[model samples]
Target: MAALMTQFHVSPSGDDSAPGTEEHPFATLPRAQRAARESVGAVLVHLRAGTHVLTEPWELTAEDSGRDGARVIYQAYGYGTDAAEQVVISGGTEITGWREHEGRWVAEVGALDTRQLSVDGQRAERAGIDGLPDGTTRTETGYRTTSLAPQQWQAPASVEFVYRGIYPWTEARCGVAAVTHTGEHTEITMAQPAFDQAKALYNYEFEYQRLTGPALPTRVENDPSFLTTPGTFALTRSHPDHHVLHYLPRSGEHPSHTRVVAPALETLLRVTAARDISFRGLIFADATWLRPNRSQGFLHYHGSGYYEGGDIYTEVLIEGRQWLTVPTETATIPACLTLEHTAGITFEGCRFTRLGGTALGATAGVGLTVRGCDFDTLAASAITLTGDRDAVLEDNLIQHIGLDYAGSPGISLLGTAGCTVAHNQVTDVPHCGIVAGPGTGTVLSNNHTDRTMGVLADGGGLYIAGPQGDSFDNGALVRGNVIDNTRTPYNFGLYTDYGAAWVQVQDNVVGQADNSAVLHVGPPLDHVVFRGNYWNSDPVGSDAVPAGVTYENNTTLTDTDELEAASSAIRARAGLLRTQEPAIG
Candidate 1:
């Protein structure tokens, strides 16, 4: 006979004060956790099918860990017995009391400062403008509007303008500082300059030299003047105690028929200093994040535009923070799930969707495994593992990530050793697909990255940047991946930037990249190897592939014989022919 294990049950219809048995379940996860901590042996917390609205994060510490060849398993009921049921742990509050105003729907959501909104499980666009109004002109200080009344520009501090820079593809958002009516034109002063005018590489003459000759296209948002489109939302506070949300519904959507949800919390779960914990078959969704403040100083690149330097630019702020006069360090926007200082933690068959920050973040952990999960519609990276050892991220589907921020990637691994990122599919991101850096012993193989770098330029589908200080990403193997359709400027199918060294890239299929060369190498490379790769395009030559690099048996798209051979080799090595589909509820 099997040894009896301790068990606790949690259900939506139960009460927390009851005994956590199969018949009488606990209502909240915290109560179940407390009971699990008091037990001596292994424990299984079974969650019933329903929605679990969490106002705050469910935290687990070292005391909650399983010990002595035992484990703690938090899983959905009917996981293996029957078909998977819907178990949604949501961080957002459902909004009610919707009415009509000026041919639009209006509601009051108390002081929730979120930029994302969803109606009937679909993301709605924030009210914005596509281009500048006619007769708008630029000045040395800011922009001037020709036909604007004083009432339209009232409360300038709460307004923001998005400017399409001289390059026409690049964009920047600036807060409004002052707005004045000068009878002839309305002058608007920005809190910061719209874009970096001083540091221009290709369009230096048009961007910096001729400042007032032609006005860049601009659009004002976060105000009430431009709330004309359907499926758009705007938040405004006319009084201190009253916050109004204005929304234009789609053609068939109505206030009484649709389900509206606004995000309330940032973090849904936090596992701290714990060991031997597993979370399975759970869905975490609908958390919000606010963008951090920008810095006054700027760091300009030679070819790219100027970048603001502050807490937003660095990765060290992921741990702790200090807010001084200059705000040297700041807190990270919390993820839907955060794991720190933990070991042997596994997240299996889970789904993370509609989150404002990262989906899953593991910092300073050991033996963390995230397998067979789905990460979708996140504002930041899908998975960010830092300072971890022997971490594994496999068989996951990461899509529609970095929707709000362009700098973060789909999967970011930093300062990690003996990590395996394999067999995942990453697509529809604004930045890189898989970015590893400043680490060692990393194996990135058998992944598929497509349609990446849709917004941001100067990145790659598979990218590595590093060798900072004494930390070297030596002996990292990147092989057997399929990357396609990188259309942004300065982007590539495979890129090694900064001081990346001693990496082996082999036996991959790269196709349909916008740049002529599929492989791109930046300066200060050391001991890199490229062998037996099949490119479905022409090589751009020395500009992308530099000297002193080992290149052998690499063929272009037209060589059908070599291409078929290479494809067969890659498929045999990975042991899988196609990507896995995401698990459904």
Candidate 2:
């Protein structure tokens, strides 16, 4: 007869006029969400532990739901304490007066504007450069390069520029607005229409979209004479109410005992249209994104690079030549814990780290349930999920993350329904480790991908882009996964791209891939279907296996004791079979 639930606690040193119980807790988290919206039936709210910082976002709507069959948790008294009892919900802004200047260190931060910085908790490194110099053209409003002497830098409108070429699967960025040198050329001005609609969404040179790399920006970053690396960091505003940051210490760092951290709110949690909520073992950290630092500049184009209005304009024709291109549900990057149109939500064992964006974002949900979570580093994609329904991402543990978006991907999902990415453990990524766009009854089972495309090339370890339902019993199902490595070089261990339709690739296991056709299937695909998989070569053994596909009886392990007895049961049924602890009190 245990039908009584209504507990509230919250802390960071209690007192929002206490009495939210647990020996009078309730300090913030909106006064324990206004006493759990005036408690009625079921409700939990706990919280406790340390840092709750947040300078904004913490919203929840549908009047913070929990009607019929009540259930509105918000846990974190989790994992029997210890380890400093984690629970951080930070949006950053720690800084503290440092002062040093000559060899770097600075500080101040008041008029703040961030692009991420962490230091003592690691994750710093922004001064950047990495290429872009040889006759850099492209200019109607930006880019001319005669080689950075941009009028002796102080702040070329906060520099930025960084790109990943004309879609080796996109990663763009913008933000500089006026540099002017004109004579030996150096122009630079950008930050408008995000580098003019990211070169009109395809980096000029259309018609087969040529230009696959530098036409200008191969990378650049904030100013201060590009800081000449050493654990980097830059950022400046000078006056208009001050802002300065600096940093350069990386030899036992000691800016008055470093702990740093920057990131000033790019949404630190918002869940609208809520219903039976539930968020256990909390830890949504830092947070970044400021629309590529204003002027809507972050026009990335593919996969999770959802170009922010999802770029359009097509024209195709091919061999008959008529090309113009640009497609697919663009504009991704926006997930620092934002769940919209929620339903019976449930995010257990949560712990999204660092996060400069793309870390736990649910959209138009219904019966969502992300289990055993713990995505790391993150700068993009460690779970995006869009237009959900009956969703259920299982046993999670996506690692490293795209750091600062290189066409990021470790679970991107889109338009799902009856979704279910199981037994997860996507690793180190830079792109594709479970993508899926346009879904329906998807079920990528027993997951496990190692080393992911690392620095992106042509995405790998499970992709799928178009049509996902209307066959294999209502489509999509690439089972028992375990793809060991794809670290670069046009990867794939199951891709299916663009015209992909009604999927089904079974019993997966591709221990190592640099692609000689580790299964990509496209040239405009359709009905797809590969069966009984287990690679080591022979995904059509050297390409040429297209045509709405269908291959059967797969298995190409050229003996190493039959590939270690069939990859030891797919590395023992792939990752985290259990582990989601918390709640000891």
Candidate 3:
């Protein structure tokens, strides 16, 4: 006979003082977690349908783990009957008591400081202006603009300078310290160290472009002077008592009618040293991070890698080409949900949306499985796995990610072994779709990518680079995947770059990309094989195989009938097996 499991309940309207039964469930997750910690064997914590707003992160540790191979499951108790019924664990506070001031609605948010705001479940644009005015030049402090008056703005110190062109793949952001008017030239001084540090990082540019410094800024944000347009919001914190929020109504929006949410917490969940935990059919939403708003702002070096204080660079040889690589000790845009030193964790059929950072991050964990999830409208990457063993990411719908940070990939796995990323639909991404960095026995298969590498350079649909074990001896395998479209200018469909070796690409399809050059190769590449693949257009990388790369049995379809028949099977087997449930692989 199977062992019986203990169950507890929690709800948005529940009371913590109750008996914690179904009829009298706990009002908060922490209360229910406290109750679960007192139990043994298998346990289930059922979160009823409603929004559970949190004051801090809902955390679980080893003390809350299950025993004897039993699992502690946190799931949605009842959701199938009503499509609108949901279990939302949010890190935002609602804004209310709106009144009209001049032409727009105004609210006195007591002391909330946030970088992201959402109105009616959709992300609202923080007030911004495009670039410095015409006669602007970079100064020792920040900039000198003759057209825009910085001294007269309501919040002088809160304006953010967001810049691109640090490289083709880097976007740097910093906060303004002070603004002053110097006769005809307005001086905007930025926060120290990070501002000067970004200039040094930009000096180490990509090999193609040996540029000087990053441009002044593509845009500037969070100034009340730039809030003239509709559908925009601005915050003025220069007041003595409270920070004021001014929101201009869109064509059909009213602050009193629509819901406005400003995210307050950076992390929604933090699990450490836990085992045998699962989250099912839940929603993790509306979390934001504000570390980038600090003086030491975000300085991105490459994908999933940012330089905080080091200007370190090392030269490496790839396929006879010499290139510079930097240290990626830590990543920028920390995940709203972080799991460290945990094992036997699974998140199934969950939704991660409207988040300001990465959805999920797991490191130093074994047997982590993320399946059948929907990730949308994120500012950073969808999923990131680092130093985890035997992790599986399958059958997830990842779309519209990297909305703010364009260099983040859809899925990134680094420094791992015995991992599988398969049957996931990664679409509408701004950078690479799937990236494998410095791992062994990693299989990236049956996945589908569409319209990837749309904004950044030096990326591809499936960018498999770095050390991938011994040459084809249970090494990394890239097979049965489909690359639908990569319409960007300087990217590829299948990329073997950065001295990646001992990898195999078999039985895949590349369609509707830059058909003239579907494949991309970077030097120091060794012992890589590409065979039994179908392309809609002829790829030009075959002309010169160089020395270590080999191409065999790769077909280019000129005939319509043969192309249609061959591509049908490869496309059918790609992406999710089913929407309701992920098929076991």
Candidate 4:
């Protein structure tokens, strides 16, 4: 004995004139969405095959559901062999002025700063030359004297330079601070000291050779005069320390205009929870916007400021403004697809295309999961996660990103934990594959990245910054990962910043790294382990690796440079092993 099931039918062709009862159905998705919001107990809705123009994106909230488990399901079908054309869900509704603020979704970008914002534990390292101690040099020639005998002279000790760079120096800089000679291997212990205002410590452990070979004369200084720009208080160096730096910039201010900047897809998906909401095989097509840039899109979970159901777009477009207008806030227009502070979101099969901007321009979310989705032709990053506690991005394809000349990264996540980014394919991007910021317990495993370069003036790959707290980052793992054609003119296979700890980089394969410097570790990068990692371009016995770092069972296949970078990488990394630890299976 079963209760009779109540049903509501909606056909755009059947009525602009009906009341939408079981006998009389109304037309349009807006009417259906409205009806579903007000109905109860497993409401099944049908759409007749045809094109439906959406002037505004639909919003689904948590309040639409009833105590008896109200449900709304949509599908297209033919009646009595009277088949219509395939249902075409086309035409994007213009969304404006929504941002993912804190752990909640908001329509106003101004509300983003009203919440608590802080860096997470676990440091992320970027390659910039900052925090190296500026040194002074005075030439001194030693001579053997016998009153009037021919005087024999010896080489000088050091040189002087200026300081104008970024912070939390790497190991090569630490070695420079010790002034170790070329071909002379010196090992130094690394440590992380606390910042005045923040909760993290910074530092890397590295090694370098002197200019004793056919290279040019040694230039001593915190910075070299030759590298300094004219009329600027800066100096540069040819050494490896000069190339790598750490970065943590402030998010730009929010715009104050009454008009909306860019709206997110989640904003329209927030139907009331009283209704059982389901987006089954729906298509959102040709989401062209007033702006042409890739950064603009929609925000989810508006007003109540918590989170809502995932708005799955089978196909969608996100563009930016034609002319660059100075934004009042750091968050500008075209920041696409922000899902902060919500759960139970699923994008089973969808395409996110044409995302641009500098940093967090595309794909900002928290507690979100994106599976079997695709990202294409993006200008900046495909995705950015901020303060997400638990998230999963699995078995997806992200490709053809970074159309803008200022290409950023594939994904950048900050202050996250319990996140799994696995089995994804990312290619033709301009920056690193996945950059995890401080205070994140993230696992980036079994992912494949190819042709990942940096922005015009930046470096590339798996840049890890330290957590805001001095305690080392826990559960940051990079395993079974494959990187191909990581062609950076300068930098490493990986970079670990100071105050970052408890990291494990294992069972990974890297190929055709154009740069010789592979793994750059900042001071205080202790308790970090690299095991069974293979670098095809890195020789097992070269100088490419910095000293004092630990490695085990790592094999390098190339060793043809002045530094023997391959051999150095092996020797330096081998030091980190406990010697008797069992090999990984």
Predicted model with the maximum lDDT: 3
Query: Cα RMSD (Å) between model 4 and the true structure?
Result: 20.8
lDDT of 4: 0.42
lDDT for each candidate structure:
0.71, 0.78, 0.82, 0.42
Better of 2 and 4 by TM-score: 4
What C-alpha root-mean-square deviation, in Å, does candidate 2 show against the real structure?
18.6
Determine which window of 10 residues in candidate 1 has minimal summed lDDT.
Answer: 295-304
Encode model 3's per-residue lDDT on 1-585: one tens digit a residue.
999999999999999998789999999999999988999889998898889999999899999887899999999986444453579999999989989877787889977777778888888888888877788889877888886566767787778887764566667788788888788778888887778876666654344544455567987888877788887888776664498888887778876589999888889999999999999899999988777767887777777777778545654534334444455355556899999999999999899988888889989899999998999989899999989999999999999998778889999998888999999999999888999998889999999999998887767788888779985875799999988778677766777787788889898888777752333454467788888888776665677765777788988886656765887777778898674344489
lDDT of 4 by residue, 391-477 (tens): 777766766654432334576666677777776777776556666766556887777776766432134455566653332354588
Which is better, 2 or 3, measured by TM-score? 3
Off by over 4 Å in 3: 79-84, 149-152, 204-209, 239-241, 314-330, 515-523, 537-540, 558-565, 579-585
Candidate 3 weakest lDDT stretch, 10 residues = 515-524
Worst 10 residues of 4 by lDDT: 149-158
What TM-score should be assigned to candidate 3? 0.93
Tens digits of per-residue lDDT, candidate 2, 495-576, equal 7777778888887877667552433333466777778877777864335656567778877785446764876776677666
lDDT of 1 by residue, 253-370 (tens): 9777899888778889999999999989998888876542131212222111234434222222122331111123323334678999999999988899988878888989999999
Q: Model 4 residue 431 lDDT?
A: 58
lDDT for residue 10 in candidate 1, whole number 0-100: 93
Alpha carbon lDDT of residue 64, candidate 3?
Answer: 84
* lDDT for predicted candidate 1 compared with the true structure: 0.71
TM-score of 1: 0.84
